[model samples]
Target: MNLRLMAALGAALMAGPALAAGGAEILKSQCVSCHAVEKPANTSFERLWERKGPDLYYAGSKFNKAWLEKWLQNPERIRPAGELYSRHVKGSDKEDVVDESTMTPHVKLSKADAEAVAAELMKLAAPEGMVEKGAFKGEKVSMSMGAMFFNKLRGCAACHSAKAGTGGASGPELYTAGERLQSDYIYSYIKNPQKIDPHVWMPTLNLAEPDLQRLTGYILQLSASEGK
Candidate 1:
């Protein structure tokens, strides 16, 4: 099935009550204050501090439908510090003394609202083939190898945390990435983050194909272990 059509189907299949409750109007009133449905004209990390929330311009391309539905109803802190990490402080000692005022929890949605919103967000699309099938499905990497690449080789630990409630607070925690993200999306983003979010804080690393496959496989392994 064409992925874009999935969004439409989501809305159509919503429990009748959720469909009856205006989804678009609910999104506009509750979500637009923070998230952007369309691509923003600007794409500069320098101006990232001004962003109220993460862009959902290509959300349909980026997120897993099941994950999105579940997350909408039970939102969690993806970014530990804040949307603009520089503005929030955790100190050099890695203390948990972050100023809580800098961050606000996502607006909690009722099951009906979450269903409607997830449906609407899923409708947001990107260019075709952004994540080709089996793109990131490659050779498996041992946990140790994945750890070495993530922590030492790629220096990803500087921003992203490999485990929940651990590592740097600047980026989203990858502890549950495999559970939350689609492998093809992960591979495509790693290959060219700029293609995904041009002004994203994550750098564009021209990692070799082998390294990319290893990293992708590693995250999947990590998530499965966590699930156990």
Candidate 2:
């Protein structure tokens, strides 16, 4: 569940190459409101904006640009399956407020401007400052510890996933949290999830800093590369 484990998982998700420093500034300013390059771990999205979307902190690393440009032109249902794993389970009665119409469109932007923004966003990296080698504590998390953390302590699987038959279905599936998210952003979100989403459907439980780290570690271990 430490940083290394998560990085390992995310690395596998990098199926294709990536390029940064294109004209993503406009994209950042325009699309970043909901798709922030941040995290949401410890707070609910409701307190942050009364409405918020998932973070784009690792867009460059996780998604393909062809898909992104197409998305800008006409978004597909990425989050429609729900952030955690809506495709797998039944979500609450409340429907998501975000719809295709609410997304920012590039129609107003000149073709060049839209492309530039898309280029910049394609360069983004997951905010990882802690997934360095030798970052985990001397002791690895025992299965008991991992199990307890997953089910009892952090219970991240609720909105997240680990190995299936666990976690939540309200957010993105966590079966690959390691490769998908930047660790530093995860840390930041755990410290203050409210900063990312003011109106997140998730609840905000007061988790201690160290506990958050443990939870992050556990979540990261669910990365995609371990078996790959």
C-alpha lDDT values of all predictions: 0.78, 0.53
Supply the TM-score for candidate 1.
0.82
TM-score of each: 0.82, 0.48
Q: 1-228, model 2: which lDDT tens digit per residue?
A: 999988987885562232233355565557666556655454453434432555666566545465455456644333334443322344346944333334443334555655666577667754554223233332334555765876766666556556544444456555545554555545555555644444455566787756666766765665533311
Model 1 regions lying over 4 Å from their true place:
1-18, 45-47, 90-97, 129-133
Can you list the residue pairs that collide in candidate 1? none
Candidate 1 C-alpha lDDT tens digits along 90-110: 665666556787777888878
Least lDDT summed over 10 consecutive residues: which range in candidate 2?
Answer: 130-139
Model 2: CA > 4 A from native: 1-80, 83-119, 122-140, 164-166, 224-228
